[model samples]
Target: MSLRSLFVDFNSYFASVEQHEDPSLRGRPVGVAPVAAETTSLIAASYEAKAFGVGTGTMVREARRRCPGIQIRVARPERYVVWHHRLMEAIDHAIPVGRVGSIDEVACELVGRQRRREVAEEIAQQVKNEVALAAPGGAIRCSIGIAPNDFLAKTASDMKKPDGLTVIELADLPHALHGLELRDLCGIGPSMEARLHEAGITTVAQLTAADKHRLRHAWGGIEGERMWGLLRGAWLPTAPTERGSIGHSHVLGPELRTPVGARAVLKKLLVKAAMRMRREEMLSGAMAVRIRFIGHDQRWERDLAFDPTDDSRELLRLLNGVLDSGNRRHPLPGPANATPLSVSVTLMRLVPRTQSSGSLFAPTQDTRRVDALVDRINNKFGYNKLYFGSMQLALEHDAAPMRIPFNRVPDTDSENEAGHDPLWLQSLNRFKAIAEGEHRRRERGGKGN
Candidate 1:
């Protein structure tokens, strides 16, 4: 009926976190990349770097050419995760957080008196103030938006950034969003934009005015109808669907460009995926392996459907079999001549471990125990500390660091060895203290009432 949702989006999340962590990095242009390699692309750029036309997907060389003094830092995913939790705690001080849209965005639901525009704006401001306090030197800032639904709220948050607050009232309707391009809306990427154009919906106004039937036809699915409802300020359900698959992909470094190196990387990836699947208590019914060759259009993929499994050894065996069969059909380029660009492994048709029945092909109980023991040892010591000998070639390479996925947050267990700061632990403690203080204050206020 009123402003039912509030969305908060961090501006240049990774770069901001780096600047916040190091006071010297503040006010300077910074870019975060997966690796320190000159050929790597920046995953995020600070606003100052953005002034020089540097941005995500800009190669490090190009970014340096644009901003001669640009600073490039390797991504610290664990630091980002720590800050995410802290920011969520800060927002929770104002209102209960609803859904975490990503590492840098969160949505909160407003109910009762909180739904009033005045109250909603007050909560937004409080959230901003808390976030500033929680961040180091008050360096982090967020844009907040309040609207009738989560979709519009997210769009409004993006309208203005770097300490912005916007409210999209229902009374404003389609006119309020007319100034934005169709791509400004979430889910409207280049391909979707082309489809919208083919359907005679080239503008936000056209999209807003599109009939549900026409939208469904344009999208070729129910998603179009859902978009139509969202455009009209109707709230849509946010329930998650069952996960379809779990996979990991890696862009090979120069050292891993050979077939032997690529296979080693693939083995590492499958082991990681298998560990994750075991953690989730999920079994995979099928598996797929893909390899992309450098300087050629020859992409090789192999898929195999077998009894459900989460054992790393069994999955690796199956993956090796797939690779063997693929090589027999189409021999890989010579070890010295070929250059592999990337490799990926996907575990498909997942089912709950509890729902899976014993299969003749499944590993024996002793094998399962061995796998569990390895997982425990790795978890206790460090990742890859007890990996299979087949992955020895990739031993020096770091395990692909945990990254936030679209539907869920990844749990990372990073050890604080020499030279590494305990910032994550400190941040966690601060969050807990703030939460406890808030709880006590609420209790006292309740008694007073």
Candidate 2:
């Protein structure tokens, strides 16, 4: 009910960072993308570029047509990660972060009620300054919003951008929400907005005033009530916490086909996912694999429990079985008849290894040593210095497939010089201690209190 949350959004982030350090690009419309491939779309655009209607997912060719003389550059992934790490440290200096949405957005739950707005604004400005200094040749700014909950905070942040500080006080609720479009809110994208318009709810105000029963009927139940409450500046009841899960789903491109090709793609994805889970120091109690055959209009899914582990090879073996189960039970239409459109994997029922049992035969020692060796190689040189065999040709086949990025490793020289609270790494030795303490506490009968 009270405004005790802060949402931080980087301002025209990638392009701003580019322009801030280089005054030459200050007034130019700029776009940052992963690859220069003709098929790749713009990932981030400057405020000047956005004014000309350029946005993420806008095709590079169309963006050029929209704004002639626009500057486009491939993003420096390593530098961006360093900037993100610095910003994260700056934010945590002000408030404990509750959730990190992406490289450019973070949410914080204010511990104390008094001075929430003042603290949030100060933190936002500090972050802007710190990121600009930490990221060389990078100029970045952020807009922040302080409100009662995540939805409102995010909405308030987006209401205005590029150095915006919009606050949504409880008293400003229903009236402030009047003319806002459905898509202006976070979850409702273009498709949902179209559906809402067809249902005769065209504005946020209208949605709030509509009948709950009718809204539920049209919007398919819980989502209707959620939208209504959000528009009224009401907070959803907080749920109990549980172990976090990691999952990813990707639809195959035109080039990927055949059962052999599909299996290879699945193995590659699973390996990457397993490595991420291992880095988090967590294990999965169950796994799920799903396949969608759009051309045949068919879907197949399988889930199974397993001894907790983060072994990539083992996960690949399990993935094979999960897919085989689906195929044996209800075979997908032939590859000729159906395109294997989508493959998804879920590492569900996650729990800390200290709390869950792992496979007795698991190669923990060998994998741990390999992970350490990989870390050493990456820190000394850069990411992908050593990689799984499945991903060796990633760069050759897919120009921009997300691989192990260089900035994933903590900065060693800076950490050594500054002893953990480096101006660059922006982390402290105490954080690791605290994390270990929490892990030990969880091992006991009680979770961290």
Candidate 3:
């Protein structure tokens, strides 16, 4: 009996979710952009759009030119996350879902006394049915790939798209993988492929047959063997158990040039990074804030140590101080010049809040009070509705993160008042019919007694 794994990958997950929610987008060439604009590129592209050479990271303009009928919608990370959670829950109901790789893809490990093939098909059918029911009136589909290992399962999943199922058995490895490019392997990224080519290893077969010593010389000891094993269908690398860091970075558009404008952008980035860190249930002991100038010649970066905080306000304050000091040291020589590059806020040294160090400066209670007030004002009226004076103009962009999916998250005040649990409700509703049957049985028993 051989071990078998099944990988179920949602097709063009974010774009598919959008299309599923909006039937009008079905069968059309649609692209999701980070922001709603002609300038923004495609963050996700549907299969219909991909047929026209439109893919993730493609500029909207180019996508349109390639497929003149392409429709572009801004990326809604919040809405997408909601659907992602729902889909994962659906899969969990069907089979043991392995760690989620990204917002869209998940691997499920098949177990039990039943045949692996039967289990894979049954689980795939269950997942398909669950998604269809949960996402009403929307078209959401997944492709299932069955293989002896995770690497092959992933490759099999990619073999078919827009509702596909591919199975790669151990015996079929040679033929199935023959003529395939080296880059098709999971770990062989562009950089690795380039290095392999430099070593005269142009194909997977060449890589598999290369001298272990020579390959080790090229790639480090562990990584070299890891690559070789993956090519031969061996799953040695275990899936990561926990998340490492939460960070966000973006290049400042033309409008964000002045010191004030830069600060506005920095605040938005900080709030975004902080919010994600909180959602992940993680806190940072140290943080890094960076800024780059127009020509890429001048750059400034600062790392600050704190008593482990995830509060947006505190993070923004530190970011402002860093920016202030950088500007003072590297004064733009004149007001006419502007920095036209990127800003990033990275939260590092992640630790569970329980393990965080006690703040020497202030009590946690006081900090929570301030965060509550800020969260309240932002949730009630709108994000940045009452911001630290630096972000007046930054709030004007309708595509800003806070404004885009404001309706998705629970309102702070309303949640405090009602105490209703949406997640719990969803869980109960999932098995309502089963519970109803039990209730009927109890009623009959009572009547008979």
Q: Pick the candidate with the highest lDDT.
A: 1
lDDT of 2 by residue, 7-115 (tens): 8888766677678656899878998765564334666789889989987666567789999888998765445556667778876765676676555677777666533
Show model 2 residue runs off by greater than 4 Å: 1-3, 21-23, 89-99, 108-139, 190-200, 210-229, 235-244, 248-265, 285-309, 320-344, 351-388, 395-449
Q: Best TM-score goes to which candidate?
A: 1
Q: Judged by lDDT relative to the true structure, which candidate is superior, 1 or 3?
A: 1
Q: What is the Cα-based TM-score of model 1?
A: 0.88
Model 2 vs. true fold: TM: 0.68
lDDT on C-alpha atoms for all candidate structures? 0.78, 0.63, 0.64
Clashing pairs in 2: 16-139, 17-139
lDDT by residue (289-354, candidate 3, tens digit) is 766554333456778887778777777777766666634754322223644345556788888877
Please give me the total number of clashing residue pairs in predicted model 2: 2
Minimal lDDT window, size 10, model 2: 415-424
Q: What lDDT score is found at residue 129 in candidate 2?
A: 67
Report how far residue 64 has shifted in candidate 3, in Å: 2.0
Question: For residues 90-170, what per-residue lDDT tens digits would candidate 1 score against the true structure?
Answer: 899989989887777888998999989999999999998899789857568899989999999999999997789999988
- Badly placed stretches (over 4 Å) of model 3 are 113-115, 122-126, 129-138, 211-221, 235-244, 251-259, 275-283, 291-314, 327-341, 352-368, 372-386, 398-449
**Residue 188, candidate 1: C-alpha displacement in angstroms:** 1.6
